[model samples]
Target: MSGSTHTVTNQPPPLVGYDVFAADRVLTEGLERHLDPGPLAETRAELTVLGRAAGSAQAREWGRLANVQPPGLRTHDPSGHRIDEVDFHPAWHRLVGKAVSAGLTAAWARPAGHLRRAAAFLVWSQVEAGHLCPVSMTHAAVPALRADPGLAALWEPRLTSTVYDFGLRPASQKAGVLLGTAMTEKQGGSDVHALTTRAEALAEDGTYTLTGHKWFCSAPMSDGFLVLAQADAGPTCFLVPRVHEDGRRNPFAIQRLKDTLGNRSNASGEVEFDGTWARRVGDEGRGVRTLAGTVAAARLDCVLGSAALMRQAVAQAVHHCTYREAFGARLVDQPLMRTVLADLAVESEAATVLALRLAAACDGAADGDERERAFLRLAVPAAKYWVTKRCTPLVAEALECLGGNGYVEESVLPRLLREAPLNSLWAGPGNVQALDVLRAVQREPGAFDAFLLEVGKARGADHRLDAAVRGLLGELGDLDAVEARARRLVERIALVLQGSLLVRYAPAEVADAFCAARLGGDGGAAFGTLPHTLGLAGIVERARPVE
Candidate 1:
């Protein structure tokens, strides 16, 4: 692998979190809904290209896992077993590839599906391994790992599946595994300080030898890992390969895999790493920082996943409404059905728009500096909390729309409903996420305020976007202080997206539609009313730009 650098400039802004107006703009721009016609169409075509080879089988395997009793109830001795020896059924692999492919294809055709395939694909990928492992950590550490010029050669061919040792590069075909870091330990679930994993530097080898037991590794069967261990300086991240290139070797012994309620496919495993060889990623003692970055990305991924799942539920409900007859009329024909569908539509739209806005924010990043990181940090918990928490009720409501069929296995609603809760639980449950949001604000009091100020300034400068942003900022200033202000931050997310979409992409008509929808015009409820009101009042008062 040769080292070649390409720089991206004029990127989109970092996404803060979810909002209704933001979603409207995306749909108007056709990002959510494609303009192309044909079997695969445009969005579908793009999704297909991005689809993992292991999608279909993964879904079926996931369904099976969902149907089975959780691993928590199953009798298994982790002390006697190793994660790798557990073979992934061959049929499961085939099913995964097909499902992922089909899911991706369907996502493009239906804006409502969006990231559903990716969510299910990821779910099954974890299940394929039969245990939960911290798989998202790799995404954060890979940049540093790949940056090591010395390791590039070894890393290149391993990244993608397309690079057939025969000839093609992995990029030519999509091939990547989830990577993660287990920050929590037996003592605490969210407190990193309680982490007991220790990394001792080996004087002779110039490498750290890691020894510790991790409480929860969420994808125990993942291809690679990012392990956090306490070094002399502090906690640090070490890139540890779980499976070797030859596809043999599992040094970490499994203590046990947690039987989770929703994310059952991947067993959440307790792992004991005994003298695992680990290369330091990023600086030592900055594991927290590295972990933070990783968490940010993972949070975004979670938000995307949540939004996609919500979209899936809503789409299924909408489909059912169109076909399932009620009182001699289509379910959609009923006023109540319309209300339910509208609520789902609006909420789903809000979640998706905020997700896309986050993508846009990262895109606009000149470099992944403190500001970008800050945006992600604040946004992660908010997005995850909002989307996942919303996912359960939204899905349930969607199921309600389906009535009896919603409860049945044959109906996808039941599966979706079951899977939805995991979105909240898997990523530091909603309450944990809320606490993360508060912590982020405390750490960087100006982070969110800066974002709103930037949007406000941009709007003031652009005549076309002025009214919308001004209206948003005014609402921000009117919120109650402290907790109430914090609440408003949620709504401001929608407003920020509104400004972002108007400036970055969407047309005037679409932007207007978004603002109207969010502001509660045209029979729409206030999209980000509570949060926007709360966060804006709290932060805006502390640091208001001189007019």
Candidate 2:
């Protein structure tokens, strides 16, 4: 009985067996605010189911196993037959299959599809992020393929199908399909115009043969790839299937799988395409324009993915603090710890609200609202720039709240921290997003007007936000050194937009703290620097995951 040395006392229980979607007040609130009444009920019911499943111990184990047992590259069969396949753990398939069946990739077909899928994505991604790569790519590819109706008709239904059909086969043979992208070359990066990959016309049926090496081919195990290559006219988009309609393997080789810092459950490969068969998606020389929808949709996913990580990090931090004790007091009850948790909660809330707002804009655009389309031209990049940038630091700070325990892989905070920067770098780097915002403001008059109208609605509702908006306007007015000052200007634009949303929808305590800390600059550089009189405890409690 005296051998009790190993008994733990102050440790918190594992944060599982709770509704991930329903527990997130901010995410649920965003759903209510964005979705119509009829759809809101059904969406909530569906998401609640996913949330519960995501929160289960079984699902958590699946996520852990998927990451630990990262996918492997199987370049050949036992007889040395060329079979470029990436071998994933069964857990990986389960996570991805659940996502696919939950309608994550079927968003393009439903009413308020973007909002519904964004909410589902944010919640399920909390379970595992890696599998969502194909999920997101399949979702984004819908619009890009639509540029060619024949291609859309051929692939759209499979890509959006709820059945998670996994394997290399002809698109015609699959009930569901995942799409990957091989656009960035070794030298070009985001500058697709600099790509040297050449595509030669093969037949009059819009078929081409591509020969190039893609530096980063995301979700390599996908059924097909939306590749960008130089055609006779110029750079154009093409769809390259993994196999021919007759079950013959395409000339696609997965050279090597990227050893990424995190999201190891997913396979990103350096692929080679020598005489790769492809069908052109749109007019040659207008590849960038044709794939603009894909880029934008992916950018939005960057924000949503980052928000999911941030939210999960904060939830873990707050949940830890609620139980772990030091010096005869729970960490959540300590003044400074509560302040830190509140600061993190505020950040998570702002990100959730802003991300859903962007999703709502997409929904509007789908409903034929040109104004929302214009608004997205500016808002998506700006939010993508700032929110994803904040995710890394916020997650790192959240991990710190657990002290040494958070540093270990068992806590999941380390995983969250590692996954944090992936979103920022995925669609394009921060600089690209900032410059995109600049381009939108300069070229699209309606975009800037739409942005201003968005922020202007909350004018005088919160003085600090108003001042920040004015400051943003003045910064926009001055074009001197604008290119050099793009990051600064974009940060202003993003913060003002977040402030506007918080002022309108967030609780008084949350909005006030956000305006004071982010807009009015009444706080210092650290998370615990918010003014002492704010409702820090209440904010922390709000973010606590219900179990």
Candidate 3:
């Protein structure tokens, strides 16, 4: 049948062919300010390439395919041999391989690595979030393995390699390998200390066998896992390889794979360890301490992950409004709509600046900067808590901008909305991060001081920031109901830090809008509540992604 000639008009063009890195003014500016000139130039060029690729038709199709056809878990072979393997679509492999080749896992081994990897992670995650599970685990496992020099020597090189080798094989045989972790048990999720999984000493050579079930084992198909189990000493950290030294499959039984709300491309499984052979990662009694570095790295990724989601959501919203006309004018130019978009822009930029600052802190600490180490100890938990919490609402609001289109699966916003809450829930819940912030202040006062010092750098730059900092210090001084008020306290701390960064680095219009809305209390409880006096148009324009 001949098609009817109906004109398609007024709809915004699909948001493709734009450069992800070049479009993000906040991210690009943050990189220039934070990274060394040489690394900045190199990373800028590399990310420009990645940005184009991430925005390409191929990458978008891969994202859709991976999510639509999530991974499947196969527990037995044809003859019923217990073969716990997860089968992912080719798109998943392609996305993950691209990430590995981009050095998302090799950050620790290169110069200015953390900053570059963090930026790349933010860029790539916009394409798809599920693949980041294994990517993040592989990157985080390096620091935890370093507790055992022998393990580090054996695993670090392969973990840092850019090749993506997928299979249950001996690490010795793979060109590269990925790592996962199983810390929380069924009975105790965040309270890992309540874990009941027991480890038996098989020999005096620091080898052991783990017998228990892990409630959440992310990246189940990774070559190895860093697991926590109760030992003779106490809860201990262990390295459980998928394959034994003699090349036999270890007794790692996959109970089931979780049916999650989002991040569908990744497989999170329930695994039972039936005499799983393992090597202790650190001292027998210091499991939590040994995993500190790993946890910190993962938490940083969590913040980056959330920030990436917010950035992409806002970009999509702005791009839609720029083209889609409503009520005889562009939606972006409407007064109330402009306010909403600008408010969202302010939030996205703040998150980007703060996340990059944390990455810069990681780079500094790696360089042995004592003050940065202290600052990071406090900043990570605070930023993780605030940023992840902010992501859900930001994505939801950005979704509202698209009206019905945003709610549908075809637009990608719905996936982003689903993926937004995972980061906050993954690393730890809000209370966990809040308690961590309190613990940092109580246990390491110096870290708290360093955080204050860092934020104080913009003390006189903006009176609103100065006043907010002063008020926060006053609140910190009064620790009454600290636990009860931990979330509020952490939120204030995050806002102040974000405000300080904006004051120092961002444009005056952006900084003023953020300060007025967030710090000065000129905004109400919801998005688009910024005072009409602020430069809303400028903020929105700055946030708009261009080709």
lDDT of each: 0.52, 0.93, 0.93
User: What are the per-model C-alpha RMSD values against the true structure?
Assistant: 13.7, 1.1, 0.9
* Regions of model 1 farther than 4 Å from truth: 1-44, 48-84, 89-92, 95-141, 144-153, 160-178, 204-206, 243-250, 366-377, 431-446, 453-547
lDDT leaderboard ranking: 2, 3, 1
Candidate 2: deviation at residue 332, Å? 0.6
- Residue pair clashes in candidate 2: none
Angstrom error of the Cα, residue 243, model 3: value is 0.9
- Per-residue lDDT for 477 in model 2? 90
Please provide, for model 3 over 334-387, each residue's C-alpha lDDT reduced to its tens digit, 9 standing for 90 to 100: 999999999999999999999999999899999999999999999999999999
Candidate 2: how large is its RMSD?
1.1
lDDT of 1 by residue, 1-547 (tens): 8876987633222211222122223333334432325422543444433333222344444545534534332223478544432234344334334333334222222333333333333323322222212333333344445434454345433432221121112222324333445556888687776778888887754368788888887655545567778888887777776654455554777666666555544456778888887777767787767655456656666666667667656655665666566677766666555655655665665666666656545533424455655566566577777676677888788778767768986666666676777766654776567656666656676666645554554454345346655665565456355454554555445445444544444443334333444443443342222222112221211111111
TM-score between candidate 2 and the true structure: 0.99
For model 1 the TM-score comes to 0.68
* Model 2 lDDT, residue 5, Cα: 66
Model 3 compared with the native: what TM-score? Answer: 0.99
Model 1, residue 347: C-alpha shift (Å): 0.9
